[model samples]
Target: MREFCDSISSYVSKQLKFSNISIYQKLNVVMSNKVYDLQYKCQLDDNVLVVAVCYFTQYLQTQQINKISAALNVFSTCAVLASKYIDDDSFQSEFFSDKLQIESETLSQLEMHVCQALQYNFALEQNQLVNIQQQLDEILVNNSNTPKMSFLEE
Candidate 1:
């Protein structure tokens, strides 16, 4: 594991520094930090992470979720989808359940929600990814939450 780079690292750490952001923004930082941990433990590829983030962001646009449970459900579900869609050796639900403490059935349902939200559209373009990153950067910069660099330090 490597560092998040100075710019992204500063922005991410700042997410935890402020206390005047919405719950959505707080969960975004949580999801971001959790994904970093999952990537290290699950040995996920950059492509899988890209797809996961895309799925998470798109699902949020269509759903009216407002709980940590729902947030983690979507976050972990997106990771499950991305790994299966993009990786040859995909992970199992039990792995996520064990790591994230979400039920396997719930993750399955959340997976269905995201897939249906996009009609099973898992493909992502470079421009779309760039746009997503920029959007997250802008939003996260304005948000506040503490993120630990447990996986890797810069």
Candidate 2:
């Protein structure tokens, strides 16, 4: 029954040229790309990606994501925190400001939002990381068919 309903919805969405992709799926793709870009641009350790994904997921659970902008902000904030927390590194604020077209100060504000949402605790146990890994795997499988959307255009 669920599959039938989804197929009907997919068909109607396609017929009307509406996006069938859910916001969460879009966020998943955008976040993965952002993490990859960070890895390439910052020469970051692989652990940073892991931490960022975990942090972003935790943030999502605590907050309601109603807009793409909010989702992106959380991702950027999580990425910055992950870099700082795991590598003792700072965000290349200028680079981010240029790319995100927001003031460097906005990053700080976003970071604070994420920190508060996460209760200011950044610690992660081995079991927590393992659980996060499983969650990520699930997201990957579920989002496999997510149609490509331009994050910038959203």
Candidate 3:
């Protein structure tokens, strides 16, 4: 999902005539804050949180420092959004409050800030899944045989 989100952000930045590397650099700066400490905070055992971090990094790449606080909110929202897709259960305000050691109301407010910063552009596509699935399908040739471990070994 993060790969997909990053791809979309890259496309948008190219469309906007901005430097993608600069956006990545700026994200690094914004993420140096305590609020961005969620990188090591989520309890999930999956890669969703990592993906959320990538999304946040890309989103931060495109935003200004004056918007960093709001961008962080959007990062949280994207994390929840990505969780909905990658995790089995949906994350709610209570879930965030319990997981991130914050209050439910505070999570709600942060979500609001994220929405405002993104202007609600939360429907970004994650094409990595589709691309990988398509490639696997082609290799399988619609046969019932399962794919080998070679793909994973790489």
Whole-structure CA lDDT of model 3: 0.48
- Residue-level error in angstroms, candidate 1, position 8: 8.7
Computed on alpha carbons, the lDDT of every model, listed in order, comes to 0.61, 0.58, 0.48
lDDT of 2 by residue, 1-154 (tens): 1222232223212222223467545544554455555556555554665576668767767776666566656666776788788765565667666665568898878878899999998998877766654544444445456442221121
- lDDT of model number 2: 0.58
| Per-residue lDDT value at 30 in model 3 | 48
Can you list the residue pairs that collide in candidate 3? 73-114, 74-114
Q: Please write out the lDDT profile of model 1 over residues 8-102, one tens digit for every residue.
A: 33333243333446754665566556666667766775556656767776776676565655665666687788888877667677887777777
Superposed model 3: Cα runs more than 4 Å off:
1-42, 65-77, 126-154
TM-score between model 3 and native? 0.43
Task: Quote the positional error of residue 105 for candidate 3 in Å.
Answer: 1.3
Candidate 1 runs further than 4 Å off: 1-29, 133-154
lDDT of 3 by residue, 24-71 (tens): 556545443322344345544224543454455455655553443444
By lDDT, the best candidate is 1
